[model samples]
Target: MVIRLLREQEEETENRGKKGPFFLLIFIIVFLSIFAFVFPFFFGFLYILGFQKVMGCFPCTGQSKKRTESGVNNDIKRKDQKKPTSGSLKVNSNGNLQKEDAAKDDRLSLDARNSNLKDQISENEINGGTKFAFGELVEATDNFSSNCFLGEGGFGKVYKGHLKRLNQVVAIKQLDQNGVQGIREFVVEIVMLSQADHPNLVKLIGYCVEGDQRLLVYEYMPLGSLENHLHDLPPGQKPLDWNTRMRIAAGAAKGLEYLHDKMNPSVIYRDLKCSNILLGEGYHAKLSDFGLAKVGPIGDKTHVSTRVMGTYGYCAPDYAMTGQLTFKSDIYSFGVAFLELITGRKAIVQTKDRGELYLVAWARPMFKDRKNFSRMVDPLLQGQYPSRGLYQALAIAAMCVQEQPTMRPAISDVVMALNYLASQNYDPQTHLAQGPCGSPSRTGAKRDNDKAQIASDGSVRD
Candidate 1:
């Protein structure tokens, strides 16, 4: 230690006495240190401060940082949001990027979202988002009371919450966070799920990722999922008319097509089912619940290889047998969902004499025969749909359920076909051509109530 200290002292003394190259070298080293270690931060600070002052001169929006709204924007805020995309990169007169000045503001937004996710992670582990606080969620949800609860699923429960900041109502999905799938699901959502932009796909808002509680917040869907509307919900809700059913089918196809074609790597919704399809306030259909969604195969690779994952009854046969998932597999599942929408019966059910009755097995054969196809429409739909349209929809559904995924129509094709069905102008008077249902005395009605039910409008009674 003494030798090292003496060496340093001699070097300092030698440098102090030197007037030529040694002193010049010392001067260069000190100057280099100022530029390397100090100048940027020192100058950058002043630059940002000056930039902020300049930015402060701009109009201050009356909208508070803690704004909240439903999916719909209030009239005033919507007006303010409509800014002209002026072809200008915001910069200060000193040539510094304005983004730096607003770094603090951006951080505050991300921080609030992150905080919300953290607070809800304990009770639901769903990795919702952190913008909201535990107290905020309690206040929003009324402390997750029974009334705020929306629905329960295999993963966890969902609650309706109102965020004062965004002035928006959102669905908070609280999911189990311990399993491998749970964490993967969180990462998948954080990485891929977003606006999804397709008319048929659902919108995902921010998420929560605090501690052990995982929650996913989404735009509140007023009408809920087709699964509950068809079979589970209380009787108070209006029955899904034929037009509503067709619209749902068409819209869902459009969503799937957008994901398959427009998204960066293309996405495959592995789990497609009625339960995952949500309806907006106006009853437009949007496919939601992307926990099992995956990016499709990239260049040169025929398909992605992974362990099989998806619900039972809705899975395509080939996809189930092999761990291979493709876009067509999703279409196949759509076929099953189509049958569910048409028949109003559970996809898989086991009964006494009929050991096991799966919709695909029974509908496949019956759908081949026109008489049988007409017989399969839901009793609720009572011949309201045009027969030709029904035939086309059924044919598309049949094509989707083909044993080979490659043979199935692309979601785009399915979307187009369903769209045609949705647009068909089936006159209500056509039902009168089939006969009466209330008074059984008239045998003119095509068949019994047991026949695939038909609604007043011409849709897939089947």
Candidate 2:
């Protein structure tokens, strides 16, 4: 009985020892599993907190990056603006005193514009010019009345207004909210016109800027634009006389000459259409709209590479094709305008007459033939223009419209030729009289025939 009791006790002890180790192992596993899940939650919370702090130190978020990019773009735009100087002209002589006096006036005007621009645009961004009260202009223009409406263009509508403050008749050009010309163009036109003061160039009286409201005030042109008289005339208005056309051409040429030759660094008048040529009382022509003008190439540079921008028919062929602009490009455009005056035809025409669709294409061949040269002259003149003067005018036009830019005459040379034509007298009967053989009809036919005869005789001998 004693031996059996001792054996049972030993077996129970062994079982107890094994069971204790197995329970301990299970407890350790349960603790480890809970720790694994809970630790991830705690670590994630800490990581998120640290991420916020890091983002605050360095702007790496999408919104912060976009703001940084916008700031840089604004800085670049501000830098590109050409701020006008307070004193643009210097007084060297009595001839320049008038220009100096005008500069003083411009300076005063600029101060006014700067004051007004302070509320809307940055003072540095806005160039110098006169700032008129929008309320005053509203009153002058009869509350933007349609009766006062004169015309409309790519910029906006123009209205004839009587400024009570200045006691002056002014033409107000309001900016179109949806027009091609925007703030950049408005500022450019104001700054350019402020510096340019010439009899043949339209004058900027003042301008009004109020938030989105933009208006330019100019001297009222009673006779309206040359386009109106030349192409689209109002009822009862007589067709422009030959002398008047000549005068307009000469004056317009002088204005271009000033832009090309007189201005420092020279200015290329990109848009030189008939409509841009405004006429004051007594048929005085003035070049209007300088928004498209660019500073010409300087320091031996042949041409300025620019995106081709101008009227279709007026753009120089080479400039249009290659985007290389020069002073000669303007000369080519001027030639087209001169042709418009001579032919009384539109720039781009679709006619039933074969080979005469475009004014330039049709006129090119006629310009070569002496007898057919008279065909190029405007029928409106009623054959009243001086034949010698017409010949001189056509010759200049031919040289200007040459396909080769180098062959085109300079604006100064064109001005000189025009000046002579303006001064020279014309006798209709004598100019158109036929020669002894009636074969030489035009003024220069006889001389041209003589030259041709001499050339033919020499060529035959060779």
The numbered model that scores best in TM-score is 2
Clashes of 2: 0
Return the top candidate by lDDT.
2
lDDT, candidates in the order shown:
0.69, 0.75
Stretches off by above 4 angstroms in model 1 are 1-130, 178-181, 430-462
TM per candidate comes to 0.66, 0.67
Return the lDDT, model 1, position 437. Answer: 27
lDDT of 2 by residue, 1-462 (tens): 899989999999989998999999999999999999899999999998987776576434344668768766766655643453344444465633212455244433354354453343333434535578789999999998999999988789999999988899999999898987766567667766877778999999878766568889999999888878877556887887667788888999999999998877588898898889999988999998776787799898989998888888888999999999999998888888888998788878766766336567777867655566566777666666665566667777777788889888789888998888777755545555434332345655443222221111111010
Error of 2 at 172 (Å): 1.0
Q: Please give, for residues 1-95, the per-residue lDDT of candidate 1 as tens digits.
A: 99999999999998778767777899999999878998889999999788768656645433344442331255454554454111222557996
